[model samples]
Target: MSAIASEVLISRLADWGVDTVFGIPGDGINGIMEGLRRNADRVKFVLVHHEEAAAFMATAYAKATGRIGVCLATSGPGGIHLANGLYDAKLDHAPVLAITGMQETSVLGTGYQQEVHLDRLYEDVSVYDQMVVNPAQLPALVDIAIRTAYARRGVAHLTVPNDIQVAEAGEQPYQLVAPAKPPATAPVYLPPPVRPRDSDVRVAADVLNAGGRTAILAGIGARGAGRLVEQLAVALDAPIIKTLSGKMVVGDDSPYTTGGIGLLGTGPSEELVEEIDTLVMLGTNFPYTKHLPEPGKVKVVQVEIEPTRAGLRLPTEVPLIGDVGATLEALLPLVTPRAERPLLERYQAKMRDWREKMAALENPERDPIAPQYLASLLDRLATDDAILTCDSGTIATWAARHWHIRGGREFYLSGNLATMAPALPYAIAVQHAYPDRQVIAYPGDGGFAMLMAEFHTAARYHLPIKVVINNNNSLGQILWEQMVLGYPEHGVRFGNPHPDYAAWARGCGGFGVHVTKAGDLETALREAFARPGPALVDVAVDPNEPPMPGKVKYEQAKHFAEAFLRGQPHKASIATTLFKDKIAQLKES
Candidate 1:
């Protein structure tokens, strides 16, 4: 018997080195599910509680592994559910292929059950969108989807009709053409390294040499070029400022780095951006344009593999379009080394002061379990090579300011989209990628509740993921945002009492720990880390504790005061905590 289209689809994916498929199954995709089942030894299907989580898992897997992440969903609602995560991949430029089911070709527009125009629905989010109407189209379509995703560094979607999925495929050899090589029977596809031209590299070097104080803003693009980035920093006597996605480029405690940039950044970094004459951006188009040095004030030399992203965020005097490692290798030789290191020294000192200020906030003896203290405790307990993920909101703030990046540790969060609840799913995918490494997910109460069912998914897989929930019982980030905008906090708090997330973990066949007091936080985190399987540590933190920006503007202070005057909830406690934190920061200054 000829192989079915679904079998061809899975076979082609495995040929592209895809080892896992993340998705939830439904009747519409039953044929595809059988394909996954038959090819279980080749490509494993991870069952997710929700289609959205599956999409998130795929996006994160792509980001973490530098491979084409594939996600599957049934027709109609399942396909619609994938939009958010696919958009996340698009914005962050993760290479992902979404395989969603469609109604039978006979009833595509007849409004049949689960009849979703998935190809039309995915056009905006995908770099390549197509539907397989025949079995012969499956293998070629799969190859095109994966190739397009890799080439464009964005989502590629292939929607297959139910009838087409089970149809017999024609005899076709699976041929994979390696870059600059003839077609081979073996499945091997490797992307060619991108390099900037010598002339462009020289122009960038000239721009850098012209400036006196140069600061390197390392983004996610500098992931594999840490040593090169350090060499350039040392040569220029420059301080490195990491974007959130670029946190692992260098350790947070490195002397060359002033820590992160933007609102979740360090005060020294803010000052460094204000003072630098030249800014060297590596592989990161940081979305917060306001935090960047004003155009023309700093001569910008940007290095990026994607040409469109080179000058997107800041005005570039010289844009070197190429791989970060390759570009840095070419430009570093032409750039002149500096001897005077006053600016780097000054920023290093400020970074030390910032660390001291943060230490005071991370005091474990504080009565209410401070989220900073919880993050610090987890940092102390996690392994050197642990992979940590955090959701957006106050949890991200705590993770950003408190958790120190050390050793081989890596951190990931929703970068451009800044969506909530991806932490748990990301942790699951990373754990699947590296089973032996410690994987932790830190999410706020609101975000955790959004995708809480995924905890059971972790349990089902025996993923051994440690989830630490910052149970503030409120949408803490938005509450502060409202206050910052001079509006009273409204509808951000959870009117219903918060559920026992720890208990839920236990119910889902995992270990659980609840820490209501500050002193118990360390013990709880330690226990969760040591547990044999998936675990949850739910710590009730102070909801009134604000995530203050690195440098508070007078307008922000005025608006916060105005919010209190306009009768904000928990105004007294919020004001007290903010005042106390500010006083500590001022003392460090």
Candidate 2:
């Protein structure tokens, strides 16, 4: 038996520490698939419907568990299926390998079935791309791909011709390469430090002396300074509000815990911030500049790692650049204690009010279930520590608003691009690496359809991921966009009758549950959550009533009115205007 033949390709993958690989099987990879079937002991192959979802699974896995995510595909159509997810991984800086199986070696010059040059096709999307013509080169090439993926800079591609995968090894000895360790940061700062504006110190004093209300806005950076954040809040006796990304840095149930702010903000967190005389912007570089209060109006002090992020939001009364934890620690010693603020009580009341109003959306009586209730119900049934991966469009809006991330749970998202169909693949990587933790795939019907084939992959490996598909039949989010844009809805509609997602799950030897009503929700969710293996929960939801991320202000309102009434394009050009600086950087780079 030739060691390099396609007959035992799984052994090489096993040697590379890969337990399962995500991809759909077809022409070019038939050899590899056969090899996997013959020696199922070592490595298993996951079969997704589209190579795109396969790639997305890799991206999620990398983010959730810090491992190199692997995906494969047949040539031409399969290879083309990977671009969207690959681009998402590139933008999020996730480590992923996209493998494409090419036609037989002899067929290279002739037009064969699905014959597209795989190497050049992925040039724009991948950081490193290669075509392996010799079996001897496979080991080293695979190693390179693994390392590049681990660095999280971009994706790596390996194109294997059908004939080459089955060819005899070149007799030369081969060795697998190990990846390098990450570089360490210096322990201490060198230059003599100018004493930072005791802004944190002043803010603490203001909150203590003013004896009224105060709010702490925690951003992603807050978690890195956990003890300091907790300490500052305790000292000031203040209520804390987190940004979406910073959801549970301070523990969602902390006595001081208020909900998120901006757009789809729930919990009178915005009201709380407005009422407070002193607002501490801790470790967050919130991009929505308009959300900031006027410099002269509020006693705004920002603690940040970057100066540009701090001053860009508003003229900071106190801009301290250092570890947020360390800064907060320094400030804690300087500030006096304070009394209870009525505004904190008021904010908590608002949080309750918002939750109550949103309760209707969660428990809708309409035929199709409300997407909000579907997600909220899932959250209640889910483990407090379960990981949630949200895909783009309406589902993202719903998830961002309703998904309650507890302190220990991780929320993985593609915030930069907000791509669709990422949840399934990400679920793969997350569940594969984290066998101890439960992972959930919260995807919209349209988004889930885009990567539904990944269901087979979930079945193959029996990875314990619960895919909650908000199967509303239409791309409701996009239809809303067209409705508001005043454009003729030429392509936004998607009312196709969906195949039985649950039956497909059962056919693949996984559990599947279809929830059509509010009463059906809890039982299905609990059943899926308790299932020992991979499962799919198909919840048919309402198509109308879009998610609310922002208030319908004059600009947004005008756009919708013009589009629906006069059929004219509205002014959402504010996004372009806001991102002008980023555009300039792109040009310079």
Candidate 3:
């Protein structure tokens, strides 16, 4: 007998270099599960507790390794559970493939048990969504789905009916058109990289050359163009401000780097944006419009691979549509180097003073552990080539400000989607992709609780990911937002009977430790990292510590004061403890 269609699908995936898949098994997908069992040596299947986690793992895998990540799920609820994570991949531009099982073709519209409109449900989040109605469509449909995902840099989805998956693939006329090759001799597909036009490059250089003070705002799209970006920054005597997703593009130690821009950014970066005569944006469509300099105030030149996103965020005088590295190379020779460096030096000095103030706040002598202290300690202890995944909320703020990215370290989060609870799943995926490298996760109490079951998934596979929980026992980011908006905090606090996450980790067959004091943080982190399997270090942090905006407006100050006067005096104490170092600067202003 010839190979089953499901087996052929798995073989095609293996041909494209997909060695691992993340998902849970069910009767609806039993055919695919059996195929996985038969192809166990070629492709490994990771059984996650929830389909959402599986989708997240796949998204992270693609983000970490520039390849198409794969995930599978059964019909009905299993397929529906993948929506959130699929949206994460969609918004963040991660290449991923999601395969969901369906009821038999005969029963698909008959209201069969566990039936779901998988194709319709996934349409919004997928770049290519299709349903396989016949066995003859097996390898071709699978191939197209994977290729579309890689080409579009988004999610590709396939809904395979249970009966079609189990049927023999060579029974139809279409199968005879192209004979099935042996599993070991399948073909592979690779998409070509896009390049920029010569005219666009020259136009960008002209815009930069005309400006008196130039600034470069880099994003994740400039990932591999570090050397080119650095060269451009040096030649122009421009200060570089990174978007949160582009934080790893320039190391914290680089003289030209002024740090992240936006709400979770530095004052120096905000100042640089305001002072610049021209803004050269690269590889990032940063969503925070208000945080950017007024569109009318500065001349904008944007470079992006996707032409549609070139000037979507800001009005541009020059939109260079091409690969970041290639465009920068072409634009470099046409531009003249600037001799004056006053603007760059001013921002660098401001950044130096800010770093000094942050260092003063990371005192180990403090009673309750400072979130910044924990993040700083983790940064010091992490390996030179470690991969860090941050969850949404206050944890993102702590990681953004304190987790200094060195040259080799990688840091990422839900950039456009800004979804919570991705830290653990992302860590698990990266650990699986690079078993020899270290993977660390920073998840807040609220985000961690959302997918806490994934801890068991890590232990079951012996992933050895280190999870650091910023246990503030509340929706800390939301609470601060309320104070800034002048709304009294309500329904934001978590009640008693707080979970002992460290103990939970132990129960899930991993090492666990809880640290309340700031002094014990480093030691606990060391012990957790030394463990052979998964580990969780839960650190109780101050719930009142706020993530300050880059520029505080007068209305924001008035609202903050109003919140404090309206039965929230704790905000005053928290502000004093957190902003004491900046008090001198405030007084001067």
Assess each prediction's global lDDT (C-alpha) against the native: 0.88, 0.70, 0.87
Model 3, runs deviating above 4 Å: 173-187, 572-576, 579-589
Clashing pairs in 3: none
Candidates sorted on lDDT, descending: 1, 3, 2
**Candidate 3 lDDT over residue span 418-506, tens digit each:** 99999999999999999999999999999999999999999999988999999989998988898888877887889798899999999
Q: What's the C-alpha lDDT at position 507 in model 3?
A: 98
Candidate 1 colliding pairs: none
Per-prediction count of colliding residue pairs? 0, 9, 0
lDDT of 1 at 69: 92
Candidate 3 Cα lDDT to native: 0.87
Residue-level lDDT tens digits of model 2 in 1-589: 5455554345555665667677788888877676677667876676666777777777776665556677888888988887888888776666678888898878897998888898998888787899887665656666666666654356888888888766775422334385332233221213234234675566645544564556788886676566677666766666787877677577655556667777656536656655667778887877666665656666667777655567667666677775577677677777676555465566566666565555545544445566777878877777878898877778777876678766567777665567777877777777877888989998887777767777777787777889998886777677667755655344655655657888988888899988888777878888888988999999887665465543444665566555545442323432332244234334433
RMSD to native, candidate 2: 10.0
Worst 10 residues of 1 by lDDT: 178-187
* Model 1 per-residue lDDT tens digits across residues 163-274: 8888776423344474233232333446767888888888888888888888999999889899999999988989999999999999986889988888888888888899
In model 3, the number of clashes is 0
